[model samples]
Target: MIQHKTLIIGYGSPIRGDDAIGPLAADALAAGPLPAGVNVISRHILTAELVEDILGADRVIFLDATVDGEPGEVRVRSLAPDASAMSTMAHFLDPRELLAWSQTLYQHEPEAYLVSAAGAFFEYSNYTLTPAAAAALEPMIERVRELIATN
Candidate 1:
């Protein structure tokens, strides 16, 4: 039997309020025990170079903060490659775009998911999360754990 490889990427701006949740949660996960063949990474933002990282994984999970739902709410959604999801800016790449890169370049797109936490504040801060966003941290981590188990 072959071991499954899983990659977990948590990315966001560390100085931006609430937005830091992604990388922070990733740090927390890395500090604990994980299943074999699982690896965790924390990034300030997603970049095109990550396409190389995805090529070897069987599954990838992204953690980030979103303003789409109630503060402290956590959402998990599956992801697929989409070339049209391109970003005009050069600094960051959307998770889906990275997946698209893997699919186009290597013809191997790993099963992917985005686990996002709703944030109430996005103002510049000293590496801190708003109260509501902080409250969602555990739930966000728990959701990732569930995905790890079921996937």
Candidate 2:
């Protein structure tokens, strides 16, 4: 029997206060026990190189910080490849853009989800999360775990 591969990528700016939640959550997950065929990666940013890694997985989960909702809000949303979801920055690529690259190059795209935590502050700080973001971290991680278990 073939084991399904699930890749969890947590990416954000480590120095940008609550923006560090993604990598922090990834690190927390990595330091614990996980089921077989599951891999966790903590990245400072998402880039073109990740498309190769993403292509190898059957499912992918992206964890990040968002400012669109109330502070400490945790949201889980499905993701799809959108060629139009281009990033203005040349260094970091959006998760959707990476998916699009995999689809264009390999003709296959894994099921993807984005688990985001609403952050109150994104100012310059060294891996520190604001009160709201810190409180939402566990929920974000739990949501990812539930996703892994259910789908």
Candidate 3:
């Protein structure tokens, strides 16, 4: 059997309202019919410590919330390492930079994709998801299902 070990990095602050979508995506994926041999992981942010985790994976997917689109919009796209995309993030690392790091540090590169749900209303102290973000869940998870089904 061909085993596809996929590492899912879902990062966002759970307490930061709509920012919680990333970790929530991890949960939705875990609860769904994810293919066997695929491994799921979640985090509040992608930091320096996840380098080794990325190195060992055959493929990787990143789940997060974005403000770059209309509320309730979901974006799914394949990602490649680009130096111009790198950022000096204080709490999180860009998915592109993560790919760049794995290649630079270990000469190991894996296919990467990003699934981002656009959200609005990131209210403070609101752990509950807003209606728009909640509406985005199904669409986001649907894309995730399709991404994982690919060899």
Per-candidate Cα RMSD to the true structure, in Å, reads 1.2, 1.3, 1.6
Please identify which of the two predictions, 1 or 2, would achieve the higher lDDT against the true structure. 1
TM-score of each: 0.96, 0.96, 0.91
Clashing pairs in 3: none
- Model 1 residue 41 lDDT? 92
On TM-score, who's better, 2 or 3?
2
Query: Which predicted model would earn the best lDDT?
Result: 1
What digit string (tens of lDDT, one per residue) describes model 2 on residues 1-151? 5567999999999999989999889998888888888999999999898988997898999999998899899999999999899999869989999999999999978999999999988988656888999999999999988988864
Query: Could you tell me the TM-score of candidate 3?
Result: 0.91
lDDT of each: 0.92, 0.91, 0.85
Model 1: per-residue Cα lDDT over 18-62, one tens digit each = 999999999999999998888999999999888888987999999
Model 1 TM-score (2 dp) = 0.96
Indicate the residue-level lDDT of 106 in model 1: 93
Comparison by TM-score, 1 against 3, better one: 1
